[model samples]
Target: MTLCLLTITTPSAVEDVIVDWFLEQEDIGDFNSMPAFGHGSHEGKMSVAERVTGRSRKTMFQLHLSLPTVERILAKLKKDFAGTEIHYMMSPLMRAGDLTAYEA
Candidate 1:
């Protein structure tokens, strides 16, 4: 089985819900999160003029899970977040955990 590292970035307002989604998944565990900022124009409290001159601020979440689990979560996210600014990236894990054990 392939292990994947999944990273997601979305508005801070949705951080709790986004993190909760992973908590609800049986195959996923031990994730990390922190605040982040993205330089870009986006629809928000800012008007068109403000958006053009502003950068989007949001939270980023990361986790590791089996490929099948990533696929399941991504499929739903792609459909449910259509036209929204939610962005995700997945990387093939080369090695994980401590020296006690390792897997690519």
Candidate 2:
């Protein structure tokens, strides 16, 4: 098995819901972790653009998870949040200095 990093981004208001859904998935196994930081832009009333704008935008939240069960978790996410945006990156770890030009 390989270590995988799962990063999820969703509307801020529904951030808790997304996190909870992942937690409940049985495929997640015993390896899971929270996001290192939460960030995004939200609609503000104080901004001059807001006065001219007629719509409120959704905020974004990012979460990180370490797990080997990638397929199952991804399936669950797709089923639960069909319309939400999701992005993921999978990489394998190599021996130290394996990819660099350095003396052992």
Candidate 3:
């Protein structure tokens, strides 16, 4: 099966809600997330402290999924997270697998 990588970055303040929303998606099997620092020139999106530091705290989630799945997920996110400062990007995944599953 073919797959794409969907990366979503959201404000740290809404991390919990974002995570919960992901967990509620029955089509999603698993995903990876971590604390991230976003450095951008969008002054309107940054807080005073972040502006001074030139970096904003964010939560990033990545999922390896089929193209159709990615589209569906993105549509849902748009509907549910409207008005929230959520950023996303998609990349074509050449391959994905666990090294441990390989034989020596």
Candidate 4:
């Protein structure tokens, strides 16, 4: 088994919808840890600065998945979210050490 970091980025406005879909996925069982963070403009923030920003607001989610191969995970994700614009990054972990040590 390998430890991989899956970072998902979605539009701020559609964060809830995307999160709901992810939680309902059969393949994605209990995540080692799942946290949601909010990023957007402040009340007094300037619109020009926001306009220059590539993404106005984005929600990043991390998941730990054990798969036979990375290709399999990618295939499954593509099949599941056909039209949804989801971006992900996968990095192979060299050493996870022990889960018990990190468990809460």
Which candidate leads in TM-score? 3
Arrange candidates by lDDT, highest first: which order? Answer: 3, 1, 4, 2
Q: Comparing 1 and 4 by lDDT, which wins?
A: 1
Instruction: Provide C-alpha RMSD values for all models, in order.
Output: 3.3, 8.1, 1.6, 6.3
22-69 per-residue lDDT for model 3 (tens digits)? 999988878999999989796247878999999999999999999999
Deviation in angstroms for 9 in model 1? 0.6
* Residue range 5-97, candidate 2, lDDT tens digits: 555544445657766776687665443334432223432332455445544333333323345466567777788778665545554443322
Model 3 residue 101 lDDT score = 81
Alpha carbon deviation, residue 37, candidate 4 (Å): 9.8
Estimate TM-scores for all models: 0.75, 0.49, 0.90, 0.58
Q: Output the lDDT of residue 65, model 2.
A: 37
Candidate 4: segments with Cα more than 4 A from true spot: 31-49, 52-55, 80-83, 94-104
Judge candidate 2 at residue 40 and give its lDDT: 32
Colliding residue pairs in candidate 4: none
Model 4 lDDT tens row, 62-82: 666664544566787688777
Instruction: Candidate 3: count the clashes.
Output: 0
Superposed Cα deviation of residue 90, candidate 4 (Å): 0.4
Q: In model 3, what lDDT does residue 66 have?
A: 94
Relative to the true structure, how large is the alpha-carbon lDDT of every model? 0.79, 0.50, 0.90, 0.59
Q: What's the distance in Å from true for residue 73, model 2?
A: 0.8
